[model samples]
Target chain A: MNLLTDLIFDYTLRNIALGAAVLGIVSGMLGSFAVLRRQGLLGDTLAHAALPGICIAYLLTGSKSPLVLFLGAAISGWVATLVLLRIVRETRIKEDSALGVVLSVFFGVGIMLLTFILKHNDANQAGLDKFLFGQAATVTAEDVNTMTILGVFALLVVAVLYKEFKIMTFDPNFAASLGFNDRWLGVILTSLIVVAVVIGLRTVGVVLMSAMLVGPAVAARQWTNRLEAMVLLAGFFGALSGVAGALISVSEANLPTGPMVILSLTVIVIISLLFAPQRGILWDIKRFSKA
Target chain B: MEIVITGILISVACALLGTFLILRKMAMMSDAISHAILPGLVAGYFFAKGPDLFAGFLGALVAALVTVTLVEALKNTQRVGGESAIGIVFPAMFALGTFLVARFFENVHLDTDAVLFGNIEFVAFDRLFIGDVDFGPQSYYVAGALCLINLLFITVFYKELKLATFDAGLAATLGFSPFFIHYALMALVSVTSVGAFTSVGAVLVVALMIVPAAAAYLLTDKLPMMIGLAAGIGALSAVLGYGLALAIDSSVAGAIVSVAGAFFFAAMLFSPSHGLIAKARRIERQRVQIGLEALLVHLLNHEGEEGEAHESEMLHLSSELRWLPQFAQQIVGVAANRGLVMQLHGHLILTDNGRRQGQQLMVH
Candidate 1:
């Protein structure tokens, strides 16, 4: 009871919890679309590509505003996708190879820019390094508010275009045949992924955001075959992990919030993998043995 | 000197493992485990009685196994795809490592930045001191041993790796466990990643692993030659990337990755068999031959027509056939030069041999 009161009363802890939960839920929903389409690696590419955008955003705006940073990240991540798609379309380089090129080259550029900024503009770059490995413990209410706004906007977009996205993800050619304009839908989906990744940047960092995108979707996939159920379950699992991570990390100051959240997600994934009925690993094993 | 030696050793180790990685379509797994080994490194450091090679190796092994096991577990569940499993496991591990660093190991000498983008220039300073004697940089010995182990493994399991990579089903039928081979290869890759990462950082280790082997793959079909060429390319890129870092005074790993990318681009453009240029040229030649054949066929059909010589009236042929005027003229000029057609008062007449050729094409 005392712990509950402390948790409810503590403003920073509450904000952190809210931010992480919102991040988890939104990324979980968006990542389901990515994971189902077999474009899980795209999330990783978007996360890395966003770094240069974040740096460029900071350089251009000279402000630490999360929204501005996020916009910058979105644009760069989108461009990286375009470049990646173009390379794959125009050349003999396979998709995996193209992914590799875009991921490393863009990250290299981002690192160069970051080191450059650190060298030349040392004073203003104090919080910038935190973006590499997130500092979720320092999240404020305003940051949470920003994440909520973005999350809601993303959810609204996904809601409005849900059917088109569903068809396109499952069968792009069929979607095109049905006059859904699959290419533009692909852009929209990629945009959503970029937004979710950018939004998760402050909480999970670039390197670890892909896990947040993949973990919940993967966990939810074990529980259900239907997309809707999986999305909802992913959101539920993600939020649960987020809240638990936030609470646990706050309770023990020695644990970092971002890692705790991811670790919590990992635990959920393990449990879901082993125990989810029907499609669960153990269930399959038992069925095989019985048969 | 020591930095270069360390770089070459790491390069050879990565490139050797990379050939199989690229072949098995598991290049990104190497990337994932390289980053995922962070938590292992931290635990290794925390528990080690002394900072030694075995500690890093043990931590790396545990981390690699955890990564491989988690990925395999996810795969077995059928819920996560292979790429997605890799995507999930590494970040979780990396995040845990970061948290471990921030929480309990704050005062420890574990620098995350150093782990990500190593200071290759400083490799000479970290000398290995065995009580009374100093034997240059510790990275050389570390990377060298890893290289030897990788070379030995490849030599011993060459046939198994080849069979499993190219055709796992066939290997399985032959009584070889493809699953066992996979685990073994991943273990070697994990150990190699740890060795290479110590000198070049984990981020650039994947680049070192993939680019050389992929470039060689594009350049050749022979397995042994591919390995040899990949090693050569790796060595060249390491040297050039090192020189580039020296010139720009920037991160050596970044420069190395950039140089490897350049090599890939070069191979993509210039490799005779599989390069983009070669493909384009092949396509261009096929298009020209196809157009010429169509032109010849059209000429033969109109050879004895009563009026409106669609094949002879060059402008009409260009318009009716939807060919550019330039292309039409080029095809016509070639046909004339090859004695396939004769121009007479804006009418095309096929020679005897041209008629035979056109008849052959029509018959076929």
Candidate 2:
């Protein structure tokens, strides 16, 4: 009981909890677009792609300003998206193939760059390597502040573009006929997705970021048909997983926060996918049996 | 020249397997199979010690078969869609594989990175010798043999494969076993994927399998033409992507995939029958036709109601329709030329013959 009180009172633990809460809210709101677009993989790809950008930013600037690294990450992420789009548009390749291709290639390049950077750079580069797997314990007050500002910005953008985003997603052709500038809408939505991914990458790492985007939204989708309700539910689920993961990781010394968060989200998704009332697998089976 | 020859051979193999993958709509299964085979690869690494390509290939093959069989069983028993089964099985299996790698083989050289993105640079290091002369690269032979085997198997059972793919029910009625064909196709996919694992890795192999076939699909509907086109596209992409990668100092697989995407985009926009551009043009033409028809109907309706032709109503009708003034004018001109309307003192009146023609047009 004494150990539990001491652990909870620790500043580091409190900071991690706060950071996870902000990340949870942001990912939950943005993941809806990702799930709707069937871009559950984009989060993973963009997160991995951020490695080189962060490394390059460090190399060029010689300072680890979260703002500069984030800018670099956004640029690389957008480039990856462009490459993915170009591949799907130009080739006879399927969307998933293009996604896999872009993801692996960009990630491979990022890994190579990271390896090179680590070998050449000083020991200060140690923490940077942790970004690949994530070390939520290392998150600072500065990170929390940055996350809060970005989260608010992302939520505001989503709020402003909610109607247009919803219409374009459900029926793009109809949206286009209404002169809704679908291209701009796509760009805005993608930018928001990229930002959400980059922010989550700091907490969850590249490998698990995609799961964060997919898991909560997928689970939330089973519970609601209305877009607003789905987004809210997804955010709530994301927060729950984030808090639970943080608590578990903090309690256990060797357990990694990112994987724990991912596992929690995965459990939520599996439950929703299998057991939720309306669109769950169990529901489908029940209906089918009756027929 | 040697590289181009090797690329062409690989492309041909990819094309053959790609067509069946696309036709079966199991294109994304290649991606799932690649990831799910990690445990097999780790196990292979443990036994083989070094980078035993064949061991990895066999392991991956076994994993692929397991994935396919399980997915098929789930689909049959649970009455689930292919995508749902794939979604559930692959991720769970992949997570399991990841757990194994992380827990037991953390320090081992075998990692997800190595399996997912293959080292093409190292592929040339292994050369299979035919007596004294080196037979190009080892992967070429391995992938080539699998491709040939796949092609032969597909060709021998072409009729059955086609029947199963197009209409499994019809094949069943005609005394053909779709189950056998399905298994054979999955086996071929497994072999091709495992064999290509060394050169392109798991992800790029999927790109090779799906992209070329998808591009070919956009260009043609006939199975034979699609197969041929897909092979050509795959070969072209492999060679071109290699050259482009060399030129840019980038990853070869990435370059190839980007190039394939470019091809697909071109087909989507410009293909004569099914391209988005063509579809858009068709929509535009239909809209024009509808507008003209609506204007003609309005004029005919007015003419039927009036004993005398009225110029005021004709002018008023043009303004009321609002959107397509030019199309409306064209309709009026066409009607007038056909002697459907007579012009008197700026008032247009429909003749008895014109009224009869209009009524006939409405009926049919």
Candidate 3:
């Protein structure tokens, strides 16, 4: 009861919880498409690739605002995607190898730039490093507003283009034959994913942001065969973990919210994989024994 | 100087293993193992009551194997995709490590920044000693031994590794367990990553491994050549990256990886056999050659026909053969350059050589 009242009354707690839920809902929705297209690791690469953009944003603007950082992250992540595609198309390097290259090399550049900023700049650069392993406790109401606006915008775009995205995800050639301009659709989908990744960076950081994108979607997959259901369930799972992680971290003295959220999502995945009907491993074993 | 040598040795070790890794399409596995080993290092430190190296290696090895096993198990369940399993497991393990680091080791020597992107700047001061006898920088010895071990491993299992990598079914039929080779290679990768962890950090370890190996892959087809070239590229990148870091006053490991990336993009654009520029040039030359042949064949067919006048007109090349005006003009210029065609009053006339070449092309 006290915790419930605290959740309602506490200013910092309310902002953290609201911010986390928005992150969860948005990432979960975009992650469904990523997982279905077998690009689960794409989120990981994009998150790592966003580091340099964040640093550059700070360097160029001298602002730590979420909106500026998100724009910077989105632009660089989009560039990385284009480079990734060009490598795969023009060279003999495979997609997996290209992904690794972009992820690591871009991150290295980001770190180098970060160190350079630290050496040349003043103490104002202190908060910039927080993106490495984010400080969820530091997310203010203004940050929450930025996250909400971005999340809502991404969700709206996905909703408006749901049909095109569906066809493109399942049978891209068929979508092309249907005169859907599937290439542009793919670009838009990835763009939406980049937005989701940028918004989550403040809460989860780069190292663990991939989990927020991947975990709920994978868990949602075990429960349903329909894409619509999977997406909704993923959002539910994401929000559940987010709120749970926020509450638990608040209760604990030293626990960080990001890892706790990831840990919560991990438990959800374990449960879904073992117990969901029709696709569950436990169900499979039981059916085999009966047979 | 010692830092450069340490960087070279470590990069070489990573690149040597990385050649096989890229070939096996397990490049990202190196990334996963690098991050997953953090919790193990934290545990190792906790258990040993200090920063003991052997305990850390053992714990990290166990952690790496566990990660591999979990990924495999998830994949075996037939639910999670292989890359998805990797994407899921590593971050969970990394997050757990971060959680542990934040909770327990906040004031300890195991700082998160040092663990993620190593402080190679201060590595010259951390010397290795044995019974009051100074050996030198500890990372140098670690990197040197790792390079030797990886070299020996590759040498001893060269045949087995090759067969398993290219054709697993044949390797199994020939009595080599592809599974054993896979695990053995992974074990070695884990050990090498732990060795490189203190020097280059976790993320740059992936850069050193994948970038140089991938660049070498683009430049060659032969396996032995690829391995040698990967090592060479890694060493060169280390030297250049160190020089860059010195100039910029930035992270040494980051500079090294960035240099490695520059080498990769260079090779991608310029390698003779497989480079984009070379390939594009080849395609362009082929297009012109095809245009030349088509022009020859078109002119030869109408050599003595009643409609030869209209068909052999220079303007008719585009109208009849569907070639663009510029392309048709370019083809005519090339044919005239080779003395195969002549422009007589704006009409394209096939010379005797052109007729002969057309006859030859017809035979083929």
Candidate closest to the true structure, highest lDDT: 3
Question: Per-residue alpha-carbon lDDT of model 3 for B97-181, expressed as tens digits?
Answer: 8788778877777866777898777778889989999889988888999999999999999999999999999999999999999
Q: List, residue by residue over A167-262, the lDDT tens digit for candidate 2.
A: 988899999999999878887887788888777777876655666776677778888889999999989998888877788777756455666676
**B1-364: candidate 2 lDDT, tens digit per residue:** 4445555666677778778777776666776676667667666666787557768667777878898887776556443345445644564556556555655665767555556667665767778898999877787787678768977886888898888888989999999998888787777777777777667766567777777777788888898888889889878987887787677666666666667767766776798876778877998878765664565555676654644355225566577677456656676677677676666777666667766766776887
Specify the highest-DockQ model's number.
Answer: 3
Clashing pairs in 3: none
C-alpha RMSD of candidate 2:
7.3
Rank list by TM-score: 3, 1, 2
Regions of model 3 farther than 4 Å from truth? none
Error of 2 at A124 (Å): 13
What TM-score fits each model?
Answer: 0.91, 0.69, 0.98
User: What RMSD, rounded to one decimal, does every model reach?
Assistant: 2.9, 7.3, 1.2
lDDT of 1 by residue, A91-203 (tens): 65567767766777677667766766776674977887666557788887877888898899998999999999999988989999999988789888889888888778888
TM-score of chain B of each: 0.93, 0.83, 0.98
Ranking by lDDT: 3, 1, 2
For each candidate, give the interface RMSD after superposing the true interface residues on Cα.
2.1, 5.3, 0.9
lDDT of 3 by residue, A117-220 (tens): 99989898888877656778888999899989999999999999999888988998999999999767877898888888888888888878888888999999
Task: Show the lowest summed lDDT stretch of 10 residues, model 3 chain B.
Answer: B106-115
lDDT (C-alpha, whole model) for all candidates: 0.83, 0.71, 0.89
